[model samples]
Target: MSEENLRAAADAVLSRLVGDAGGTARLRVDQWRAVEALVVERRRTLVVQRTGWGKSAVYFVATALLRERGSGPTVIVSPLLALMRNQIDAAERAGIRARTINSANPEEWEAVRLEVASGEVDVLLVSPERLNNPDFRDGVLPELAATTGLLVVDEAHCISDWGHDFRPDYRRLRTMLADLPPGVPVLATTATANARVTADVAEQLGTGGDTPDALVLRGPLERESLSLGVLRLPDAAHRLAWLDGHLNELPGSGIVYTLTVAAAEEVAAFLRQRGHAVAAYTGRTENADREAAEADLLDNRVKALVATSALGMGFDKPDLGFVVHLGSPSSPIAYYQQVGRAGRGVEHADVLLLPGPEDEAIWRYFASLAFPAEEQVRRTLEVLAASDRPLSLPALEPLVELRRSRLETMLKVLDVDGAVRRVRGGWVATGAPWSYDRERYDWVARQREAEQRAMKEYAATAECRMEFLRRQLDDEGAAPCGRCDNCAGPRFTPEVDPAALEAARGELGRPGVEVEPRRMWPTGLPSVGLELKGRIPPGEQAAPGRALGRLSDIGWGNRLRPLLEQGAPDGRVPDDVADAVVAVLADWAKGPGGWASGRPEAPARPVGVVTVASRTRPLLVRSLGERIAAVGRIPLLGTVEYSDDAVDARVPRSNSAQRLRALHGALTVPGTLAEAIAGGGPVLLVDDFTETGWTLAVAARLLRRAGAEAVMPLVLAVRG
Candidate 1:
């Protein structure tokens, strides 16, 4: 058919399906133009519009017109299962024949295929993964293609890994339809896109030539009705309290995204405990249970749903009032998708991101998981290159040794690693997998490194959160989103007073105040002296208490602990230190008080300390210490290990663990540790890493119960 004839047919179809025909018609005026353009344009095309932009109407109208003019059934591939169902339901509402093929039925697939082959179906909604299947493409698609009218790919942004919801399978649509007759014309649609997404669509559609004809319609991304808020809580209990309080005020339906399945369940249970009607879903949930949860959300039977990222796609409930991140998300892209669920069909929605330390760790872990080792990349490529066609499951098992359940995960990791591509038949190695070239690795590594930096940047960003998010998408010239966290953080800070700092420091530096290293295993630390030299004590031992004392005196207490792990029973001293052991111990013991406090303490663990007779039983405690008088303004450096037990009888534990426990206890109960004695008030708890805040909470409780007046927890690293 010539372009003139195609335009004429599209116009006729628009008139019959939408034009002044009786009741409500599907297509809008602009949709008619798009349909005509899609039919007549030789190159693949994109139609970018906001939600409710009559995109579906245009596709159907054009499809109906073409099918009536002897074109075959129009194949519409969708990423959303719910959207597909809705589309089919809408077709049924219009008295049009439509059917959906999914993983549910094997027997009926043949019938569906026959119907398409016999021209009994005009439109078929399928998933990208399903379309790429050989059985579907070979057995059904070929038959459907003979008379197929047109091809439509929805939620087209998913084809881009740069997209917020990238699906590797979406990239296969190009090859899946490779055998189709030329000029079938592919129509791609999406709600929002940056220049990257737009360019990605063009490239994937084979329309990347200069001055490509692509319709990039855009509307405001701002939702005025949405009130965004962010909170940086120290612990989950506090966060849970906040969640409970706000959940009561939130309207319509809401979603709570958690990083782990346990967290999802915990939040759901906590909400139920507080009398909020809530349900939970995660990757581990059975499909039936997942379906029920989704149905409840759609029917408004459940007021709230707590879930992981697994529950976001293929779901479309438009009246979501708000979305709350129980913890921080790994990236802004993920954050956007989870929060985007709200205000979908409504005028506005609210999103709250509650980050502490754990959320950051979650993102870091994900980054690590997604980044495949160079060897992993090479192995994946070797397997793909050795295969005749795209291989799946059992066929590729010997190569990757990946279990069926783990196959997709491994493939996805490789996908993000940019080592492989999803092709028409299966996965194919995209480029030479392993590169010793530092430049190439560095370039590829930057993609992920940049994203990780973005995660960190989001945490530290003081700019408008909305603008920051847009910048992350590489969208430039973005206007400030006035209703974000950055706009709100400034509302509460008071001016700093330098005089106050001076007064505070002067008052804190008191005599007889020393900040000792919080002993990790006070009761179980293994000890050695000249007395046990020939016995080779139950556990390896060479360092004497004098050596430890000397090291502690010289500000080496922190370093001495780790070295203790490698202690040998042989009394070996430096050749220059024939009689300097005493001086060394004393000097080591004199570490700087301020520096000692800054050191991170690992948690006290069950460890056996060796004695002359045997290894002592498992015991837990901070560094062993002998109660010393509050002596001199010369503050103690690291935690001094002292316990009532004799060095010969007690079992030793790791110093870091002991310090961690002490830190927890100090945070939980202030004015209890050596620091408090120096500071002259409440004690402070400190740790090196804090992800979920659970350990901190436990520490706080222990300290409080132990009669500490106040506990302040501090950590070096915190996640979302």
Candidate 2:
């Protein structure tokens, strides 16, 4: 087909996709270029245009033209559920049949698969994770790959480890791409990709040379509809106050992006208290709840949905009016993608980022969750190689020292590298020779550090905010956006309502978080030197406890984290923080689930206090215990002692099995403290912080064995 014919076909489909807003919507020159490359030339392509540039239209239009030519269905590898839903709806608007198979809709998968096999579906949407499913990867994918007409990888930047939001599962697409039959045109699209990420993704899109080299349709990255700004508040509370005061003035319903799930919930709750109709959306939110939240936001029933990065991509509300960040993301690319969500459908949308002091701490914590050291990678491979059968994550977890989340991530990477394969039962070694990619991993780490610095510069830069972000993406055309805080002369002010500020302060200052005791022993504990498994013996368990806050909590947690930090100098607890702990204890005792609630289910009131031994902040721990004991009018039982080897045993980074093994004999209940505990009531077990809860669990067991009726653990902070 000629470019004229492609443009005509694309315009007709675009009319149906957009439906009568104007008589017939026409594709722009670049959108037509992407469509022409895919349909006429049948070339692989990558579209890196700004948000709202109709990248979807390029593929949907191509799918229509190709299907008119009797091509098989277009298979899209989408990243988020919300994205899939939006694309499916858009496909139907264009009169194209679309089906989806994602983690959320497993029940409909068989029906969708049957439709696909029968050639009844025009477009099939799936998550990147679905590409890694054992059955699908081994069974459905090959068949789907063979007969597919067009392959669309939405959010293609994820295919590159260098992308801001890279996922190990996404890289698995390379296999399918390599296997794709020649002449099956492929298209990858993203609104946010830097030069490095764009290069990597384009290279992969042209993998196996099934088609001509990728025709890259790179465009400027500037959202003129978005008016960007950064409001640097003094603290989390003041930021909340700013939102409470100014949210309604920011045009239409929008998203309030937060740095953490806890912060999202906290801000959502605070906003609701201020009488704003809002909901919190996070990765932790249930599928049904997330769906409802999305629906509410779409219909403008809520002013905003407090969200983390979970709501980043695939949410389509073209008329979204505003986006406020409680804290800035670590990367400018990531920030651009999120802020892109707004102003896509509207002429002008407010984009305000409230950068807090805690942003760096949050970034560092997430950075720590990336690829583990090579030693861990090597040991994981060796363990898999020695196994006779596939090992489930539970069984494999004990053999490796990585946490469950980290372990799963590592396994995904190994699967993509051909060093491992996930089968029906679990994961198995493929016996593939895999050289550790130390250089690649180090390079990615360095890139992340660079991105972090870039993000800091973004917040601090006096130049146009959008221009700053575009420059970070290596867009040579970047210039003054003329719509940012700096260029537009401060469209928003930092002044917050006094009443709202006080309310925010009160909400944040009020503190008490439940520390649910670990009930069952971690899986494969016996794989270590311990003989524990299944439900923990009730008598040996610690009672449900309390903490002043979680390290990620936007309230007291932000205040307490520094003092309880690992290497902080040993000093007595500050009077104000000590008072907060006392307040938490008071609330926990009298609260609904408290031992002092006088309910029949409540445990006997803690009769005394026993402080956990801490090597790093002994003074802080002892002082907190003394304060609690003095306030409660209970005896200050002696601090538990750590054996000589406890330091090595209490490795903070180890998994549950290794940590428990180290703690097994390293903790000793002082004979004197044990005597005090004998025949006693529930006692308050105090600690500066609990990372894995192993310390509290081990100490509680010893106290229980010694004769305490119950042990209630309390701490200044709970490490998230």
Identify the candidate with maximal lDDT: 2
> Which residue runs of candidate 2 sit more than 4 Å off their true CA positions?
1-3, 21-23, 644-647
Each candidate's lDDT (Cα)? 0.54, 0.89
Question: Over the stretch 1-720, how does candidate 1's per-residue lDDT look in tens digits?
Answer: 765676555555544443335443434456656776666563356776544455676787677666666777778888755577667765554445777777645577778877877779888878777755657756676666655678888888888766656676676675545555666667888765666677878676763334344554444444454556666654555566667666766778888888877567756876786678889988778767877888888888888889988766546666788888877666665565567668767876777777754554445445544434456446657878876678654445434422333456557545545666555656877664444344644554466566667766776777777777666654556677677757744321122234433432222211111212221222211221111112322122111122222111111221222233223232222222222222322332343322133334321210111111112211111112101111112222222122334233121121222233333322222333334333232233433223334344444344334433433343222321
Write the residue-wise lDDT of candidate 2 on 1-720 in tens digits: 666766777799899988855646778889988888888888999999888889998899999999999999999999899998899999999999999999988999889999999999999998899998988998899999999999999999988899889899998989998888888899999999989999999899878843567889899887889898888888878988889999889899999999999889988999998999999999999999999999999999999999999999989999999988888899889999999999887789998889888788888888988899889989998888998988888887778888878999999999999999999988999998988899999999999999999988988899888878888999988899888889978998889999999999999998788888988888877766678989889999999888888888789878987886656688998999889888888888888868879999877788999998877888889999999999899999898788766656666566777678778888999889999999989999999888898889999999999999999999988887
Candidate 1 segments whose C-alpha is farther than 4 A from its true place: 1-33, 40-43, 50-54, 207-215, 218-220, 380-445, 455-463, 471-477, 480-720
**Global fold similarity of model 2 (TM-score):** 0.98
Give the distance in Å from residue 448's predicted Cα in candidate 2 to where it truly belongs: 1.0
Error of 1 at 117 (Å): 1.5
Cα RMSD (Å) per model? 16.5, 1.5
TM-score per candidate, chains pooled = 0.59, 0.98
lDDT for 330 (candidate 1): 60
